[model samples]
Target chain A: MRLADLGERSGVPLATVKYYLREGLLPPGRRVNATQAEYDESHLRRLRLVRAMIQVGRIPVATVREVLAHVDDDSLGLTVRLGAALWALPHPAGEAPGAPAEAAGPSREAADDPHRAAADLLVDELLARLGWSAARELGALSPAHRALVATLATLHRLGYPLDADDLLPYARTMEQAAAHDLDRMEQLPTPREQTEYAVASAALFEPVLLNLRRLAQCEESNRRYGL
Target chain B: MRLADLGERSGVPLATVKYYLREGLLPPGRRVNATQAEYDESHLRRLRLVRAMIQVGRIPVATVREVLAHVDDDSLGLTVRLGAALWALPHPAGEAPGAPAEAAGPSREAADDPHRAAADLLVDELLARLGWSAARELGALSPAHRALVATLATLHRLGYPLDADDLLPYARTMEQAAAHDLDRMEQLPTPREQTEYAVASAALFEPVLLNLRRLAQCEESNRRYGL
Candidate 1:
């Protein structure tokens, strides 16, 4: 396959495929001659993954580069590699006062703040209730832990009350979803395939989970209000 | 309370409060005399909601206005009002080629497309598995349904295989989360409180659901790979 066929087969435009090649998102095909190079099945496969991340996941190219690099490094353990990809993917956090959404999450400098302490504690309690020691073992050190706490603190500041118990149901369900995800990914043939699956699934299926919740809420509202 | 006092109580800056007033996000305080007006608890409450949507939800001002109007219309039934709010909130959908994330959802112009048909039938199967006729009854017309279908379609186009059974567990759990949300809102005293709570909770707690999944994925990955 040539670059043109790679693009056509993958349903990506030729120019965009060229752009990915230039950005090193897709490695150059084997040099066939002065003005032409031949792509193989591997190039097509890589191009497909890159397109999924950029197009469906809306991931920035630099982050995609980091994710691809993490997946490429086989010296790391499976969990570590997968964790790197998850970390590289976007997760929302609380915003600073009047700050833009991009600059979210409360500062660590506010460790003495009661609101921060309370929110952080809520995450621990929720994790405990779900019996998730992997999350609890890391305590406030985990990025996801910090991010959840910051989001809770922001909710508190806005006069919306939240408790660990309130999140228990959602937490349990999210854990269930994660189990389903990992179980499915385990059947994949290779580490790279599993990591790619994890990264893409996290980014893409998030919307499925989110919109399903919304759609269900709609049904619930209709039931309650006689719509 | 006066304008300054209103801003103080809401934790919204005085400048931002004034800007909200100018932007029609907040109605003007009762006129006390020239250059003076009195604000009450209601004004304080509205300001809080406005700040939550802007700072936490990252919702645009125009969409907030639409949502607020939906809530404010006393003539509309409870479900209608709530549905309007849900519609106004952001939901991820499939992106068009070369399109930005903002312009998502497959265009209706392609009604005959097989990918669209398969993705949509997948949603119907998912709804049937959950016994959610409310979602099924609405069909292709519902934004959330369409959004989910479009999302699944995008996944298929990217070479990701998904089945209705794969989403059944997730949909069941998301329905549970919605039950939790609506039950909590049912306890609020007034329609205004309930509506405001629904809007705020939907925007703010979305992060909790999202990050919790990431954290749970971390735990699951660790369990499988032996972190």
Candidate 2:
């Protein structure tokens, strides 16, 4: 298929498809002549995946490129690919205090950024206490750690006063959910299929979890407020 | 305190605070003279919340205004206030196939958007079958509905072939998590505290849920690859 047909068939705009090509998000089609190139089914598949990550998953282009590179690299093992995807994706407050939503209050800078250190320590203690060894195994500053630390910092600044005990249950709940997801993915027959399933779970079905939480929140609010 | 002091105490930049003021995210400070105005602790708190929503939560300014308006409107009940926060947040893929992530292939336009309608019906049936009555109460096109439908469409386009049965476990998991969150929030004594907690959950801690999922994915991948 020509570039135009790739755009038409994929339902992605021609300009957007060209942009992806320029960004190296979508690999260039086979060079048919001086001015024209041809795309194939593989390009179509890649295009859909790129669109899914950028458009649906709301991942930035750089991150998308990193993640796709990992997904396409057969030299890396499945776990490495998975880690690559996890690392490439954005976290809630990984940037922390500078970002407003998760920023620590004035108290954060008090006494040599004690709040930051305490938040970090608290997360370590919480994980150790909860026995989430897999997460701990990733080291102290992994994406999960960054995310957890940021949440703890934000909670403290917000006056919630959460401790390790408060977080253990949530961690356990997520562990169980992840276990369930992995159990399902394990049944797939091929590594490629499994990787695709993992990517799909991360990219597409993630909203199911978040949306369900919102639904549950709505339900609870209704129960409490009788709305 | 004056606006400068308000900005200082909140640790938000004076210019950004002023922006929030002009944007109606922060209520006007009390006028003290022709050129001066007095602010109070409430203003500081509101500023922090506004910052949290915009910076950490990544909510649009317009949505923040709508949410804050609900939070401040005493005429509204607790349920209404809760609904207000939920309503103001963005859905994962509320725009659907129109967005690239879930664009249906050649089959999408064959029968005048049947894929969309089918996806909607599948979500509705899934909720009903799973007995997620609380979500159902929000009607057919709630944020949760929009999110779920978009996810369904994306999964279909991605060739995942999911149905309600496949999603039941995930919905159940989130329901359990929500129940836990609400149970904790209910421990707070006043509606103000509860509302603050609710907003924090929706904004900051929500990342905890997402990040934990990533952690779980990494762990599962490690296990699969024997890493």
Candidate 3:
């Protein structure tokens, strides 16, 4: 297939495909002649994935490149690839990734940023309670860990107290979701595909969970406050 | 407290506090003299909430204005206030809110956007399965409804298969979250405070849930593919 057809079949515009290729986000096609090139199924898949990362995941192109690197690196183990993929995305309003490993006094984040210090403590307690090995190994390097820390810190900063007991339900139920998500990913034939599924789930299905939570919150409010 | 104190305590800058007042994101402080005004505890809380909506929620100022309007309207019932608050947040990529209520072929969203149409069906199925009252009343007008529809549409457009069964666990677990959230809100003394809590939850706590899911997904991957 030609570049135009690859763009059309993937539902990305021609100029955008050219931009991606120029930016090294997409690989070069097979040269068909002096003026044209042919793309295959893998090119089509890559184009769609890039578009979703940018448009749906709302990840910057640079971060998309970082995440794709993890997906494409076959030397990494399956769990490791998925861990790196999750780590690759940016954490919103959290302490910078790979920062503040030392848990004691005078750490820059602890000294300069109390929210992060408090968040770190909460994340430590949550992980300790759950005893998840991947997150334990990845620790502060994982964007997921930082994001959780940051959010808990946000709630606390706003005067909403969230103890480990308050968060146990969320942690336990998310384990169920994680198990379901992994059960599906493990059934896939390739390790790369499994990592891809994890990445896609992060972008695509998360909104589903969030919206459902919002919808259910409406129900609970009605049950409590209808008069 | 004076305007300066309000700004200092909220950690919002004096200029930004003035901007909020100018933009009507904050109410006018009590006029103490020709040049200055006094603020109160409510002003402090409102300032914090507005800052959280903008900084933590990443909501645009215009949408914050819209949501604040709902929170300030005491004439509305408690559940009604929550429903309106949820409705006021932006749906990332769904159909225009308040569009395509008919569910018939001639609706503009149905005619023009198959994703919105497909999303409508999925939301209907999920709501019917749960039989939630507020969502049932609000229907397509709700931002939660539109966001769910939009996200499902995104997954489908990206060629991911998500059945109602795939989404059931998310909906059910979110009900547990919603119940916990609402129980907390119900204990607050004021209806207005309850709505404020709902708005805050939508912004602040959602990240915690999402990151936990990501952390758990890593654990699942490790359990299966550790080598």
Query: If you score just chain A, what TM-score does every candidate get?
Result: 0.89, 0.78, 0.84
lDDT tens readout by residue for model 3, B60-141: 9999999999999999987788788877875444222233343223225755768657766777787888777668777766
lDDT of 3 by residue, A148-168 (tens): 776676666665658887788
* Candidate 1 global TM-score: 0.92
Comparing 1 and 3 on DockQ, the stronger one: 1
- Considering only chain B, report the TM-score of each candidate against the true chain B: 0.91, 0.81, 0.85
Per-residue alpha-carbon lDDT of candidate 2 for residues B44-109, written as tens digits (9 for 90 to 100): 777877787777677889888777777766777887777776666776652334644332232244
On residues A126-157, what C-alpha lDDT tens digit does candidate 1 reach at each position?
88888898888875556677778888877777
Better of 2 and 3 by TM-score: 3
Candidate 2 — which residues are off by over 4 angstroms? A1-44, A60-62, A94-111, A158-161, B1-9, B14-43, B94-111
Cα lDDT, model 1, residue B17: 98
Q: Could you give the DockQ of candidate 2?
A: 0.44
Docking class of 1: medium
Looking at model 1, the pairs that clash are A94-A105
lDDT of 2 by residue, A127-175 (tens): 6886666777765446666666666666566444577777777777777
Ranking by TM-score: 1, 3, 2
lDDT (CA) for every model shown?
Answer: 0.80, 0.71, 0.76
Residues B1-227 of candidate 1 have per-residue lDDT tens digits of: 99999889887889999999999999888899999999998898889889989987888899899889887877778888888877788776755555323224434533666666678678878888888877788876677777787778777776776998788888888878888899999998888778888888787788888889999999988887887
Complex DockQ per candidate: 0.71, 0.44, 0.51
Please say which candidate is ahead in DockQ: 2 or 3: 3
RMSD values for the candidates in order, in angstroms, are: 2.7, 5.1, 4.4
